[model samples]
Target: MSRKEKTWWWVAGIAILVYCLFPIAWIVSVSFKPPADLNSGGFLPDNATFDNYRTILTGNAKDLFRPALRNSFGICLIATAISCLLSMFAAYAIARLDFPGKKLILSTALVVAIFPVISIVTPLFNVWRQIGLYDTWLGLIIPYLSLTLPISIWTMSAFFREIPWEMEQAAQVDGATTWQAFRKVIVPLAAPGVFTTAIIAFFIAWNDFVYGISLTSTDAARPVPAALGLFSGASQFEDPTGAIAAAAVIVTIPVVVLVLLFQRRIVAGLTNGAVKG
Candidate 1:
């Protein structure tokens, strides 16, 4: 490529990076600002304080924040585990075994994945109320499966298709039982794909706001995103912007850490699955 082309690409990359990170930078800056400086419209506050963090962490807002955090962790983990487990088995079957309706299953999953979530929320709301599952962690987990399972099946199926069938056959021929061969041979080779699917599923369950808010009336099962919407400041007249910013920053930390820690695995899993399949 010409030097001019390289220069333009560099400029474009830097611009995109800034565009993505600018909101996060602003949130972090706002979180540190005192309530007085919140509306000052400055990129950096003249005076910064830890009061917002303190309030949400140890003061008045703890009641809401703590339970919401717990609910988020519990619900997302449970949903992700369930989704990945079901998706793993289904994906394995689709990738390795020829079945009568295999193409139909994949097509159905695609349809479900692309279906508008809002279209089903109202019906789900009534059904949950009738079954008494509304406002419970299990309530959230079930719907999340609908969201996570399709994509996970698609992702892991691609990964599974790339695995050598001979490896499993060789293990079987070596006197290993079918289950033993699968457990001992297939799973180890597919670990990266499984981990990547789990992460994707977890992110979907964790960040869901529509169901989180619409289904739960209280903190009992409300996740952080829904809880953040309900947050209030010291007075009704006071803007909760700084406190909300602090909470947003705190909520983002785990996602950032997960990406930084497993970035290579995520990239490899995606690229390998994409190219091989």
Candidate 2:
């Protein structure tokens, strides 16, 4: 590339990075600021302190934040596990089997995935209440599956299609059952895809807010996103801005760590067979 082109690319890359990271940076900065410095109109806090973190960690908001954190972790993890398991099987069938309704199945998943969450929440809320699922962990997990499963199936199908068919055929010929070959051979080879799908599924369920808030009236099954919405200051007059920012930063930590740790697997899963070998 020409030096001018390289310079322009560098400029564009830096601009995009700054645009994306600026909000996170601002949140981190605000998290360290005390209540008094929240309105100081500065990018960096003049009196940086740990008070906001403490507030959410061990102070007045502990009861609200900690339980919600647990709920978010548990629900997302369970949802991701179920989504990955079910998607792996369904995707394998879609990719490998010459079954009827293959196109129809994929199309249905696509349609369901694109369906608006808001449009369904009202009837879902009534249904859950009637079925004794409202304000429960299962309630959130079920809707989360609706969000995570279709995408998981789509991504894993792409990965499965890329895997060499001969590998599974050889395994089956060597006296292994089809299910055994799939479980012992195909699944391990798709580890990167599985990890990628799990992270994506977890993120979808973790960041969910509408169902979290709409279905649950209390913290019993309320997730971090919903709990963060209900954060209150000492009194009605006080704003929970710093506490909210701190909680946001804390909630963001796991996502950042997951991306940093598995970024290579994620990239590989995404680009596994984009180009012909």
Candidate 3:
């Protein structure tokens, strides 16, 4: 509130902004530089072009790995949709309704969330192979649901608890059923939380490499992260760094845009019920 404090705050804000943007600035800068200059010690590109993007995009079908991008997009989007929907209802019930052993169930979900994902990978891989789901998109998705589901439930439950029970009671008094109140009234007020949870779930699935790499074998089922590993370095396929940088840029752009667009909702989701209404 004082002049000195305000000046210090402004200086701190600029410092944080530069720190966060520095990596992005470097990535974009690298994306333009020639292959020869990729390792060169330079902050800015001396010879920049779109050739990296063009080369990767127009490369041969066998080596380009474009199909992996499609796979990642389709799988991540679908998994996020399902995970968000399931989390909303679970959160609603836990927040708004009383059930036998409700606290126990919530406790179990939290415990499961704390368990290391790597610990289950072996058994999961075995089960997937036994059930004939191994090396398939669905196989990867099933595990991904686990990754997104617990957090989604936790986040959504916190959000729903912020809404007063009186709102739902009022809706019921006006002839709305419980489901109707949830669908029409509660969901609308919780739209920001839902959007925020969906984005989180999407990114969880999108950025996943462990499951994608272990579960899927072929290009058709493998996601972009796995494909990136496969495409890098080749005696026959020289000049892969440029392609790698280009792919990194392409994969990163959408997430950055989405985060910026829905940042308001994300902040609301994180802070919605911090203070009692």
lDDT of each: 0.91, 0.94, 0.85
CA lDDT, candidate 1, residue 222: 94
Instruction: Please state the error at residue 209 of candidate 1 in Å.
Output: 0.3
Q: Whose lDDT is greatest here?
A: 2
Scanning candidate 2 in windows of ten residues, the lowest lDDT window is 268-277
Could you tally the backbone clashes for each prediction?
0, 0, 0
Tell me how far the alpha carbon of residue 34 in candidate 1 is from the true structure, in angstroms, after superposition. Answer: 1.9
Q: Which regions in candidate 2 have their CA more than 4 angstroms from the true location?
A: none
- Scored against the true structure, residue 222 in model 3 reaches a CA lDDT of 92
Please write out the lDDT profile of model 1 over residues 21-91, one tens digit for every residue. Answer: 99999999999998889889999978988999998999889999989999998999999898988998899
- What TM-score, computed on C-alpha atoms, does each candidate reach? 0.95, 0.97, 0.92
Lowest lDDT sum, 10 consecutive residues, model 3, at 55-64
lDDT of 1 at 71: 96
Error of 1 at 44 (Å): 0.7
Cα RMSD for candidates in order: 1.6, 1.0, 2.0
lDDT comparison, 1 vs 2, better candidate: 2
lDDT-better candidate, 2 vs 3 = 2
* Candidate 2 structure quality by residue, lDDT tens digits, 195-217: 99999999999899999999998
Any runs in candidate 3 off by more than 4 Å, and if so which? 60-63, 233-239
Clashing pairs in model 3, backbone N/Cα/C closer than 3 A: none
How do these models rank on lDDT, best leading?
2, 1, 3
The residue-level lDDT of candidate 3 at 13 comes to: 100
